[model samples]
Every structure is written in structure tokens, then in C-alpha cells.
Target chain A: GIQVEQSPPDLILQEGANSTLRCNFSDSVNNLQWFHQNPWGQLINLFYIPSGTKQNGRLSATTVATERYSLLYISSSQTTDSGVYFCAVASVYGGATNKLIFGTGTLLAVQP
Target chain B: EAGVTQFPSHSVIEKGQTVTLRCDPISGHDNLYWYRRVMGKEIKFLLHFVKESKQDESGMPNNRFLAERTGGTYSTLKVQPAELEDSGVYFCASSQDRVGYSYEQYFGPGTRLTVT
Candidate 1:
């Protein structure tokens, strides 16, 4: 089984601050995704970067598959961003189903 | 387009009782998946359904959990005689089956299950 570890288990920041979250996996992966579990418990897809870099507005993510790690950056974070951020990956050995294995997640709290 | 949607946003039942949760994936999606977060732990995969067939259920905890996707449109997960340890948030996700391309999975608001 592959292991996914997230850094800074808990984080707190002022609104408009910036932060970066890291995710490290134990093995090679064919799919890597960043998700935001909002206060309502809705898992919103942030990015699906199996490799390379991608950005959406104030959020960006970069994945170095060869290094088995990924980084997610939030710039000028807002109170609405206060929630759990998760990094999930599907191992190459997962076959065509691509069932995701999730990390414990980074709990982010943005105070206004 | 509508994203993944789950029924009975929350469920509370006594131990040994039966509970069934439903998930309706986005239109035109062929891949449906079930995952849960138990005791505030990491969300774990339960199973994957490709259309009407069970593609993989290796992650299922035990025989107490049964999942079905009849006609390949909507799916249901039934927990028979649920145990206290079954309390958690169950999430459903869906994505298109792209052969050579990797597609992002969209998740529904999870169902919070509490078994006393």
C-alpha cells in the first residue's frame, strides 16, 4: 500500500495571507488531485495534476511525480478557504479503476 | 451540469440496524466510486464501479457492506447490521472513463452516518 503524508497537520492564517501545503507519497502514482473539503463537507476538486504545474486564480499546484510529492499554494487566502485541504493519489498499480488513496489532510483556518 | 449528488444527507441508526445510502453521479459518467472518512481519519476508498459492474471492491472493509449499481446509472450502498465503528462521512465521486487521459473526479456532499 502507498502512504500519503501531509505537512503542518494544522495551519492558521489571517485572511489575505499566503500559505503552502505539501503532500508526499510513498510510491509512484498515475493520478494526483488536490481537494478542498468545505465546511459543508463537500469535497471540491481543486486540481488534478498527475504531473506538472497548474493554477486557478489565487490557487496553484505543482506535482513532481519523479519526486513523489506535490505542493499547493494559496495566495491571499479568504475566510471561505478555511477548511480541510486533501491530497489524494491513485497508484499506478491501481489499474484502470483509479481508486484514490487520500492523505490525512491539512486543516486550514483563515481568520478575518 | 449537475455534479455528484447523494441522498439522505445524514443518517442515525441503532447498532445492528440496516442503512442504505444512495449516490447519483453526473450525466454521461461511467466511473462511480465510494469512499468514507471514519473517526476523523483519512478518507478510505470503499469500491469502484465501472458502469453497472463492480470494477474493484478490494477496499471494502467486510461483508457487512454491500454496493450495487443496477442499470449503471445510480448506485446504492447498504450496510447490514451496522456497527458503531461505521460512523463516518461517506462520499461519492464520479468521473468520465477516458482511456488515455486522466479526468478529475467530482465529489458529492458526503452523507454523515452515526450508528449508536
Candidate 2:
């Protein structure tokens, strides 16, 4: 089993502020994703980066697979971004299976 | 275009009662998954279904939890004689099968279950 640890267990930021959250995994993974559990408990997929960097609107993520860690950056944050951000990983052993072990999650509160 | 969808956004039942949760994945998706998150705990994997076949169910806690995907379109998870510990948020997710590795899983809003 792989272990996932997210840093900054809790974060508070003002609107328009920028923050970077980190996720560290114990072993190499073939599937690494960043998810935002909104106020309604809706798990929204933010990024699916196993390697390299990707940007989507105000959110971007970079995964250094070799280092077994990933970073998620949010710029010009808004109140709507307030919620829990989670990082989940699945090892290659699962192959096409779908069991992602989630981290403890980073609770973010973006005050408006 | 639609993402994964689960039925009965919330459920409340007495102990020893039976409860079933439903999940409708995106059209054409071959992979479906079931996960749970108890109070003050991170989300834990329950099982995975690859188009009607059980891929891996090692995460299932016990035999009381039965999951089925008939016809490979929609899936259902049945908890027979549910107990207090079964109370939690059950999440349903789906993803497409890629060449080497799997893709990102699209999750539903999740069903909040409460047992008395």
C-alpha cells in the first residue's frame, strides 16, 4: 500500500491571495490527482498529473514523480475556492484498476 | 458531458436495516469505483468495477457490503443489516481506460448515510 501525505493541513487565505499546497507520496505512482471537495462535499477533479505540469484556469499542478511529490498552486483565489483539497495516488500494480488512496486533505478557507 | 451521478443524496435508516446506494457513471466509461469516508477519516476505497466485472475488491471492509454493476451502465452498493459503523459518505467515481495507466476519476457529489 502507498502512503500519501498532504502538507499545510489547514490554510486560510484572503481573496486574490496565492497559495501552494504540497502532496508527498511514499512510493512511485501511476495515477496522481488533485481534487477539491467543495462546500457541498462535491469532489471536483482539479488535475490529473502523474508527471510534468498542467494549468487549468486559476489552478495549476506540477508532479515530480521521481521525487514522489506534487504541488498544487492556486492564484488569485476566490471565496468559492474554500474547501478541502485532497491528493490521491494509485500504484502501477493496480494497472487499470480504480482504487485511489487519498491523503488527509488540506482544508483551505478563502475569506472573501 | 455529464459527470458521475449518485442517487438518494442522503439516507437515514435504523440499525440492521438494508440500504442501497446507486451510481450512474458517464456514458461510455468502462471503469467505476466505490469509496467511503467515515467521520473524521479520509476517503477509503471500497471496490472497483470494470464494466460489470469486479476488478479489485480488496478494500471492501466485510461481506455485508455487496456491490453490483448490472449491464455495465449503472452500479449499486447494498449494505445488508447496516450497522452504526456503516454510517458515512459513500462516493462513486468513474474513469476511462488509458493505454498504460488509468485516467483521472470523476467523482459524484456522494451519498451521506446515517444509521441509528
User: Best-fitting candidate, measured by TM-score?
Assistant: 1
Looking at model 2, how many pairs of residues clash? 0
Chain B TM-score, one value per candidate, order as shown = 0.97, 0.96
CAPRI tier for the interface of model 2:
medium
Candidate 2 per-residue lDDT, tens place, A32-83, comes to 9999988777788899999999999999999999999999999999999999
Work out the iRMS of candidate 1: 1.1
Per residue, candidate 1 scores C-alpha lDDT tens digits across B1-116 of: 99899999999999999999999999989999999999989999999999999999998999999999999999999999899999999999999996775667889999999999
lDDT of predicted model 1: 0.94
Residue lDDT tens for model 1, A1-103: 8899999799999999999999999999988999999897778999999899999999999999999999999999999999999999989887888889999
Q: Over 4 Å off in model 1, which ranges?
A: none
Per-candidate total of colliding backbone pairs? 0, 0
Superposition-based RMSD of candidate 1 using all C-alpha atoms, in angstroms = 1.2
